[model samples]
Target chain A: MSKLLTDLIEALRCLPGVGGKSAQRMAFHLLERERERGLRLASALEQAMQRIGNCTRCRNFSEEPVCSICASSSRDRHVLCVVESPTELAAIEQATGYRGQYFVLLGRLSPLDGLGPEELGLGLLTERLAEGEIEEMIIATNPTVEGEATAHYLAQLARAAGVKPTRLAHGVPLGGELEYVDRGTLAHAFGSRQSL
Target chain B: MSKLLTDLIEALRCLPGVGGKSAQRMAFHLLERERERGLRLASALEQAMQRIGNCTRCRNFSEEPVCSICASSSRDRHVLCVVESPTELAAIEQATGYRGQYFVLLGRLSPLDGLGPEELGLGLLTERLAEGEIEEMIIATNPTVEGEATAHYLAQLARAAGVKPTRLAHGVPLGGELEYVDRGTLAHAFGSRQSL
Candidate 1:
């Protein structure tokens, strides 16, 4: 193989879930089928790398220090949704019809993985809470152990700061079959059943 | 979303099998964790796009008009292996232990898809056959209907040019169970048994 082609294939392997064969397919597709789009992807990557950075307020991706979510006046400043990543934040925004602001952790607490509250931007979250603008915080982290630990840690901080912090409800998902539902989720759902 | 970040996500979707969610994940990973590698990927894409083009001799990717395979003095110049694409050619080189030069069709004969013998680079194959340097042409296109049709057409061309043409053998793959094998392949394997 040519040096240029080899280098491109090697570099493409850095993408998530991309392996040697997939990288080769991507390289060939770009070179043989979509040269213009390939070049555009290159340019976009370069520009995003140079311009985009962590939003200082919420830690979501942004070109400026403050992201659009943090800067917008239409959103509810009093209600903040805490998420582990920007993708999760976007999912919540779209699926749940959330009109409040968001604080992206970019990761979760995993002691084995050397990730902790500080790494997840808890210090920044505390600072925002100290400003007395946020009335409530929703822990919208995933149900995984790491996400649960991170949410608990954030709740402890919120309690100490006198801010109300609530977790997302855990129950049988809508359209979920009881037979297929796991024991843990079923127990949680039964334990937290709402009274009509 | 920031313009650069949004553009990056949109551009990443051009990769085969990558959807919106995967593209977003890739974009975030590049911006947050792998900026240097992302930049390297961009540079590699740019360099490959600027330097690589189809080899004039065999239609494989090359920086020059003639590819390295076509220019190599060690490979058998009198024998040629014809394949549907460069990926197929590389696969054959790696798996089959074939040391012959290759002619990449780059596409199959699919009239419905507007691909014909001319589009498959058969014109160039014919011109090369007319020169009389090749003694045998191996049809290694594929097992699909289009590939079989292409192989037959190439065989006719080789016969008219007085060059011996052979198709790659069809049989049950090694280590494959007869029960699990498709009926067509099983029949072909039964019919093409070798002498001990």
Candidate 2:
């Protein structure tokens, strides 16, 4: 194989799930048939890696200092949503009608991984909470152990800043069969049953 | 999402087996963690796309006019192996100690798909066979209908050029159990049993 070809196969393994065989296939596919698209992908990757940065306000990925969501005046400034990562923030935007400002944690409180409050920019979040423009803070962290702990910490911050804090509801997922649902989820759903 | 981020996700979809969700995950993974590797991958892709072209001698992918396999002096020039694609050529090189030279057809003889002898670079292959340097031509095409037809066509070409033609033996695989093997393979194996 050519050095360039081998380099491509090796480099493609940088992707999340790609391994040696998959990388080889991707490399061959690009070389044999998709050279044009492969070049375009290279350019896109270069531009993205060089230009994209975290938004100053929400810490979401953006080419500019402030992301479009954070810069827009039409979104609700009084209500702020806090999530663990840009991926989760995108999920909220796509799946719901969330029109509020966002605060991206970029990670949960993984002390073992050395991702502490400072690493997640909690100080910046605290400053935003104390700015007096935000009346309500919604913590939409995942239901994991670290996420719950992070939510508790954020709620304390919101309260300290005189802002009302709320958490997303968790239970059995919509349209899940009770018999097929996991025991923990079923139990939690039963415990939190709501009145009509 | 930023346009650059979205464009990256879309551009990543050009890779084989990657869909929207996987592309999104790959984009986020690159942005959050593997930005440096991602940039290196970009450079690799660009170089491979721009520099890698087919070997003039064997039609295998190469940065040079002739691929290393075809250009090497140690490889047997008298015994030529024909394969459908560069992937199959690489497979043969890895799985076997076949030190013979190679002629990559790049595609099988699928006339319905408008792939014929000329499209497969068979004219170049015939010219090589006619050069009298090759004494034996090994057909290593896959055991499919199109591959068989291509092998037969290549055999006739070898005979016209006074070169001996041989096909890869087709039977049950080495580790395959007789009872579990498919009927077609079992019958073929039984019919072709040698006097060992």
Best model number under TM-score: 2
Two-chain DockQ for model 2? 0.84
Candidate 2, residue A40: lDDT: 100
CAPRI quality level assigned to candidate 1 from its DockQ score: medium
Tell me the spans in candidate 1 whose CA falls farther than 4 Å from its real position. A109-120, A144-146, A177-187, B109-120, B175-196
lDDT measured at residue B110 in model 2 versus the true structure, 0 to 100: 95
Most DockQ-accurate candidate: 2
Superposition error at A153 for model 1 (Å): 3.7
> TM-score of the second chain in each model?
0.93, 0.95
Candidate 2 per-residue C-alpha lDDT over B41-84 given as tens digits, one digit per residue, 9 for 90 to 100: 99999999999999999999999998899889999989999999
DockQ each:
0.70, 0.84
Per-residue C-alpha lDDT of model 1 across residues A81-185, encoded as one tens digit per residue: 999988787678768878888999988998788887778888889899999988899999999987888888899988888889999999999999999999999
Q: Estimate each model's TM-score.
A: 0.87, 0.92
Worst lDDT run of 10 residues, candidate 2 chain B, spans B170-179
Clashes of each: 0, 0
